[model samples]
Target: MEAREKRLIFPFSAIVGQEKAKLALLCVAVNPLIGGVLLKGDKGTGKSTLVRALANVLPEIEVVADCSFNCNPMNPLEMCDSCYERYERGESLPIAKRRMRVVDLPLSVTIDRLVGTIDVERFLREGKKALQPGILAEANRGVLYIDEVNLLDDYIADSLLDAAAMGWNTIEREGISFRHPARFILVGSMNPEEGDLRPQILDRFGLCVEVSAPMNPEERIEIVKRVEEFHEDPISFYKKFESEEKKLTEKIVKAKELLPKVEISDDLLKLLAETVINLGIKTNRAEITTIKTAKAIGALNGRRRVSLEDLEKAMELALPHRLRDKPFQKPPQMKPPKPKDDKEHNHDHKHDHKHEHKKEEKSGSARNQGIGSLEQNFRSIEAKIPRIESKNFDGSEFTGYRSSRDVSITVVNFPKGIPVSYVPSKGEIRDVDFYNSAICAVLNDKKPPIKLEMKDIRVRVRKAKAPTLWVLLLDSSGSMAVKRRISIAKGIAEKLVESGYIKKSKMALIVAKGNQAEIFVSPTKNYWEVLEKIESVPTGGRTPLSSALYNLLLLANRERMKDKSVKVRAFLITDGKASVPLFGKRIKDEIIELAKALRKKGIELNIYDTNGKGINPGISYVPILKDIANAKVCKI
Candidate 1:
C-alpha cells in the first residue's frame, strides 16, 4: 500500500456528484464536538471512498511535540501524565503542527492493541515496568477509522465504546492503571448486509449520511472514467482537482467560523424532535444531534439564521432514521359506517326464532312487511323466556370495556351445584392472570343439572401496558457480505429501529462472527450506523454463530436488568450461516445448547433467516435452537 500522505486526495470541494455526503462530512470535521455522521447504502456505493476522501477537505492539525499519537499541544484538557508533570514543573514544552493522521483499525485486532497492554519487552529487559501506549493512544486528536465496523470483535467494540463515550481511555488490562486522552472522531463504515453495528456506538455520531452508487448511467460512467484516470496516474488526476480542492478547504474554514452564527429556531428543533420520535426512532441523541447538525448545515449554506427551508433540509436528513410514524403508525380506528337507526334495530329485534312480534306499516312496502312478522316472533320468545333470580345483572362482572366492534357475551346463570367461585392456588400470582384463571364449579352428579345464577362474575379484556424488548442478533458471517444480505439487513434494521415490528419496545443487537460476538452498537436511534455497519462487513472469515450467541446471553443479562433493566429481548438476524475459521468447534450441539440457555433465561429469541433461498449448514443450526426456550424463526 502507498504511504498515508501520498494516498491523500486533493480536496473536498473538487468532489463530484456526492455533494450531500461531502457537505455532511465537512460539518463533522469542522466541529468534531458535533459528534459524528453515519454513512450508509451499499457496497461500491462510495461509503468508504467518501469517508477516505474526507482527509482532503479538512485542514491539518497541531499537536504536542514528540508524541507518536499526535496528542494535542494546545488543549491542556487532554495532556498525558508525563506531559502534565513536565508542564507543571515549569518545563518548556515543544509543539508541532502537521497533517492530521487517519488511523484505520482492522476487525481482527486484539484488546492489547486497542486499549493498552503490558510491554513484554519492558518486562523481560527491565524486569517489569510501566505499560506501553496502544492504538487508542495513537488515535487521540485524529480519525479512528474502522471499516466493516459492524463485524468488530466484542472486546474491541466495548473498549472503543468506552473510550469514545468518555473521551478518555482508561486501561484495566493486566493489572495496569494507566489513563490518557482519547478524544477522536470515530468514523466507521459497514454494509448492513452482513450485520448491524450495535446501538450504543451509533448514538455517538452527530451526523449520518447514506450514500449509494449513482443510479443514472451518466454519473456511473463518470465514476468509472474517474477511477480509470486515477488508476493510470493518481498524481496527475489529483493535480487536476487540486485547485478546486483548495477552494473547498477555504469553504470549510468559513463554515466553521460561521457555525456559531447559524441559528435553528425552536419550531425546527421541535420538528426535529417530533419527526424523529414520530418515526418511532429511539435515542434522545438523534434529537440532540439534529439541533447541532441543522446549525452546521445552515452555516454551510451561508445563511445567518435557520429558516423553514433550512429546517426542512435538516429535518429531511435528521428524521429519516428517527421517524416512528413511517413504519409503525397504527391504522386509524375506523368508525363503523353508521348503522341504520334503532328503527331498523327494532325491526331486526322484532323477529324471534320461535315467534314473531310484527309492526304493520301503512305504506305497505314489502321490506317493512317483513318487520311485522319479526316483531310477532320477538314478543313470543320474550314472553316464554324465564328470568334467573338473585343474579347481579349489572355489567360489573366484566373486566373492562370493549371496543365498539367487539360483541359482548354475558352468561345469565350457572348450572345447579356449579358456582363461579374464586379458587386459591399454591403459587405466586398475578392479579390479572388470577382473574382470567377463574372457572365455574360444575356438578357432574346429576343428569340434566338445574341452573342457578352467580351473584357476581366478570371477565373482560383490558388494555394493559407491558413493554417488550427485542434483540437483533445480526449475522456478521461472510456470506452476509452479498448484496441481498446488505439490502435485506438494511431494510429490516431500519424498519425495526422505526419500531415497525414491535412498537414501543426497545431493541438490541448482537454481532456474531469467528469466535467473536460484539455489541457493535446498542439499541437506540443511531440506527443509521447499524445500517452502515451492515453493508460494510467484509467477506473474509468463517462465522462463529455459537460463541457469539453465548456472549449475547451475558449482554442480555446486563441489558435486561437480570442485573439492571428488567426489560430484555434478543433478535438473532442471520442467514444462519456458521463457520469453522476460528477455534470454536463448529458443532450443531454447541449452538443448540447456547440457544437452549437463551430460552431458559426468558429472553425472547427470534432467528431471522436473511439468507434468500436455500439454507447453509450454518443456518441449519437454527433448527437445533428449538431446544432452547421461547425461540421463534422467521424469514426476513
Candidate 2:
C-alpha cells in the first residue's frame, strides 16, 4: 500500500465562537444516522474551515483494500456486490485502515458524474457490468461537503438529499442495475443572502446552525491573531493545538461507542413530540432527528441516560429551520362605521352645523395622519401574502427555472447544451453517440470496429438552459394603501425576485406611483438590488397603469431587439385601477390599447390583483386587461 500525502489543516479545537455549529458537527460525526447538518450564515465565518478540520478529529475505519465504494470488510451487508460475492465464496478480502475522508462535491457536478456512469466500451468488449464509481461512492461511510449549497442546481440538490436520506445510490440505466452504500454525514454550508433551498429540501437536513462573525472586540482580535499565527507557521500553529485535537478525537470515538447504549425515557419521548407539535412542524423527521440528536449528545457527554439538558440542546439545533408559521391566514374582519341618527343630524344642522363641519375636518385630518402607521406595519402583512405563480408557461426560456426543450435538431450545433440521450440519425450525423453505437453493435453480436452501416449512427439530443428576464410593474398608488395592499405587493415582488435569482434570471422593477410610471430598476441579474429597491417604494398617488404598461412594452421591445431569443415576461401588480391616463384618451381606453399593443408584440403578461375589502373600492380593470392582453391573473 502507498502512503497518503498529508495537508496542513487548522485544528478543530482552535476555532473560536460558533459553539453550536461545532457541537452539531460532532453530533453527526458520533452518529451519522442523525442525518446531516446545514450551516447557514454569512461568508468568511469559517464554515468550510470547520468542515475540513473535522476530518482530523474523526476515527479511522476498516474497509476492503481494493473496493471503490469504501466497502466495510467485516460487514458483508454493507459491502459492494463484488466484495460480498467474494466473501460468500469463502475468499478472504484484503482489509485496510484509513481515516474517514471529507469529500468535496463541486458545484458543477452533473447527474451522471454524481451517481456514476457505466463504462460503455468495457461493457461491450468484456460482456460484463463494470461500474465507474462517483463522488457518492467515495463518500460512503465518510462525509460529503457541499459549499454554497443554496446555489446548487435544484435537480442535483434533490438527488443529493434523496441519496442522503436513503443511505444508498442505485444506478439503473440502459437495462443495467448496480447499487452501492452511500451512507455519509452530509454537511452543506451556504450564505443566506445568496438564496434559500426549497422547503422540502431544507427540512431533509437533520439539524441546522446559524453562524456569524464574532461581534465582541476581544473575540475578533483573538481570531485575527490566531489566523496570522497560522499563516506565519502552519505546522507550529497546528502543533500548538495537537493535544486538544487528540483529546477531542478520543472523545468522539468514545461517543460513537456509547451511542447505542444511551437510552431516553418515555417522558422525554413525549416531551419531544410535544415540542415539535408546539413549533408547528408537521414533519415526523423532526421528532426522529430530535431524539437521535439528544441521544448523541448524551453519549458525547459520557452519560448513559438522556436528560432534559440534552433534549434542550438537541432542539436548539434540530428544530429552528423546521419551525413553521401559519401563512396566508385571513385578517380580522373590520367593523363597519355607524350611521348618524336623523334627529341628531337635524339638531346639528340647526345649531352646531359649523362645529360639526370643524369636527369633520379634524376626523379627515386624523385619517390622513394614519398612513405612516400603515407603512410601518408592512412587515406584519408579509406573512399573509400568498405565493404567486404564472397561469400558463409558454415554454419560453424565461418561463421556468428548469431547462426548456428545444425541438430543433440544431441543438448539436450548440456546444453549451447538455447531451442527454441518443436517437437514430435521420441524415448525416454531426455528433455521434458512440456509447449507444457500441451497445447496438454488441446487441447484434458484432465485434468492435466491425460496423459500416448508416443505420448504426445515432444523433445526440441535448437540453439547454436559458436565462429569464422578469419585468415587475408594481402599483404604488394611494388606493394600495388600503388593507396594506402596497406592503403585500412588495412582499410578492420580493418572492418573485427570489425565484428569479434561483432561476438565474434578470429582474427589473417599474413603479407606477406619483404622476407617471418610471423604471426604478433596469433589467439586471442582481436580484438583491431588486429586493432592496422594493422595500423603500412609497405609496400615495394615482394608478398610472397606462404609463406603466407603455414603459413595459418599450422595455420588452428593447430587450427583444438586443437579443432575438430573450424571454421577457411582465408582472403588473394593481387593483385594475387605471386612474391616470397616458395619452389624451380616457384611462380605460388608453390602458386597453396599450395592453393590446403589448399582446401583439408577443410579450407575456401576468397580472397580480391587489384588490380587497377597503373604504375606497377602485374600479377593477383586470378583466378587461386580462382579456385584451391575454394575461394571467393572480388575486392577492
Candidate 3:
C-alpha cells in the first residue's frame, strides 16, 4: 500500500459521532467469533471509513509464510494444504507477521473472482492447472469489507453466505477443486433505499447497527472541518490522530486477550430471551448473537462478567435489523445521569418532593380507574375496532405519512435510481470487469486453448433498470359505484400519486369498467398524468376487476422479463365488485387465483377498498383478495 493511500484513509479514532457504529466494529475485533457486524445507514455517514479504519486499528496476526489462505500458525486443524504438508513433513515453517487488512469485495466481483478459480495466466504459461486464490482467500484472518452489500450479485452473495456460515470457502469449477479456511470479520455497509439485503444474508450478520449523519450542528461542523483538513493534507491530518490510533490498537489487543475470560450470567441470558420474546422475534439466532455481543462488550470494558448495561447495549446493536420496528415505539434509552453539585442535587430533591405529593393526590383517581391493572381491556377495545376484511397491510405509520402534508412510502427493492448492478446479466465490457468475462470464457470452453478465441469472448453485464413502475388498478363499475366510489377512489389516487412522486417511482393507471380494463395512463414519472386521468375516467360499467388484475399481471410480467431488478407494485383501488371475468366460472374465484399467482411472480399488491362504512364494511370478495394476494388492505 502506498503512503498516500494510507494517509488518505480517515483514522478510526478520529471519526466524529457514529459511536454506535465504531463500538459494533470494535466488538467484532475483540471477538470475531461473534460472526460479523453490519453497518446500515445512508451514504456519507462515515460507515465505509469506520470499516476501513478497522484494518489499521487491529493488532497484527501470525500466519504461515507463503500460505495463500493465510493459515493460522498455531491452529493446524484449520491450516491450508501447503501449511499442513510442511507440518506433516516435520519441516520448520516460516512464520510471518502482518497487519490485518480490509480486503474490498467490489460490486463487480463474480464467483470466480470471489472464490478460488483456475490460474488462467499460470495455466497459459505452464499448461498446468493451479489454484488462484480469490478475495475470500486474501481476506482470510482479516476483514472482508463489502460496501453497498445489498447491491452485490445474487451468485456472489450466496457464496458469501456459505463461506461466512461454514468458516471455509469450497470451490469446484472448470476442473479445479479447492477448500481453505476463510474465517474473517465480514463487514458490510449499505443504504436501505437501494435494496434490502436478502434474508439469508441478513441472518449471517451477528450484529446490525444503523448509523446516520450527526444531527448536532457542532458535531456536523467538526466533521466538516476534519474532513476538509484530511482532504487538503492527508498526511498531516493522519499524523494528528496517529497516537490515538495506536492507543486504540493496543486496547483491541488487550480486549482480545481478555475476551476468553469474559462470562455471561444466567440472569442476563434469561433477560435476553425475555427481550427477544417481547419484541416478537422468531429466530434463536437473535438470542445467540445478543449473548455473544454482550460478552464481547463486557470484554471490551475489561469486565469478567457481562452486566445488564452490556446486555442492553448488545440488544440495541443486534435487534433492530432482526425485528420489525413498531412505529412511534422506541427502546428506553438508559443513559447515566450526569453528576451534579450539592446545590443542584438539593434542587432536584426539592422538585421530586413536590412531584411525589402531586402523584399521591392523583393515586386515588388512578386506583379507582384501575390505571395500574394489567388486563385485557385494551385488547377488547382494539378488537371491537372492527376487522375490516378489506385491509391487511403493515400497520406501522408510513415513514413520511402526513395527512395534512405530502405523503411518501419508502418503497424497497425499487429499480436502480442510478446505475445499480443488481442483476448479474452480461452487458458491454468495462475495463476493470473484463477479468470476469475472461475467466467465464475459460470455464465455458470445452477444451483448454493454447491461445485466446474471439468467439468465446463475453462481456460483463449489470442491471441498468432504474426507477420503479407503480401500476394503479382502479375499479369504476356500476352506477352506484360511480356516484359513491369514483370520488373516494379519486382522492385515494391523488394520495398515492403524491407518494409515488416522493418515492421517485413511475406511475401507471388502469381503469376497470364495463367488462374490460383500459390503460388510462401509461407508466410515467409525471404524477400529473395520474391526477388528470382520475378526474376524467369513465365510470358506471359492469365490474371487470379480474380483467384489470390480469392486465396488471401482464404488465408486471413484461417488466420482469425485460429487467427482473425493477420493482413493480400494483395498487388495486376497488370495492371488490367483480361481476364479469374475461374467462372462468366465478370472477371473484378467478381474481383470487390470479392475485396469488401475480404476488408469487414478484409484483406486490396493495388493495385500497373504496367501500362505505357501517352495515356493509367491505365486500366478501375483498377478504378473498386479501388472503390470496397477501396484500396490505386499506379502506379509502
Give the whole-model CA lDDT for all candidates, comma-separated.
0.57, 0.74, 0.70
Off by over 4 Å in 2: 1-6, 120-129, 325-420, 423-434, 437-460, 464-471, 479-509, 515-537, 544-567, 575-602, 609-629, 633-636
lDDT of 2 by residue, 227-268 (tens): 999889877888888889889989999999999999987656
Top-TM-score structure, candidate number? 2
Model 2 score (lDDT): 0.74
How many steric overlaps are in each model, in order? 56, 0, 5
In the range 227-252, model 1's lDDT, one tens digit per residue, is 88777877777777777767766777
Q: Each model's TM-score?
A: 0.52, 0.73, 0.63
Q: What is the C-alpha RMSD of each candidate to the true structure, in Å?
A: 27.3, 13.9, 11.6
Per-residue lDDT for 470-580 in model 3, tens only?
888888776336435665565556557666654556688999989788888877654544666776777786887778888898887777677565778788888777778
Clashing pairs in 2: none
Candidate 1, residue 131: Cα displacement in angstroms equals: 3.4
- Poorest stretch of ten by lDDT in candidate 1: 330-339
Off by over 4 Å in 1: 1-4, 7-15, 270-282, 324-636
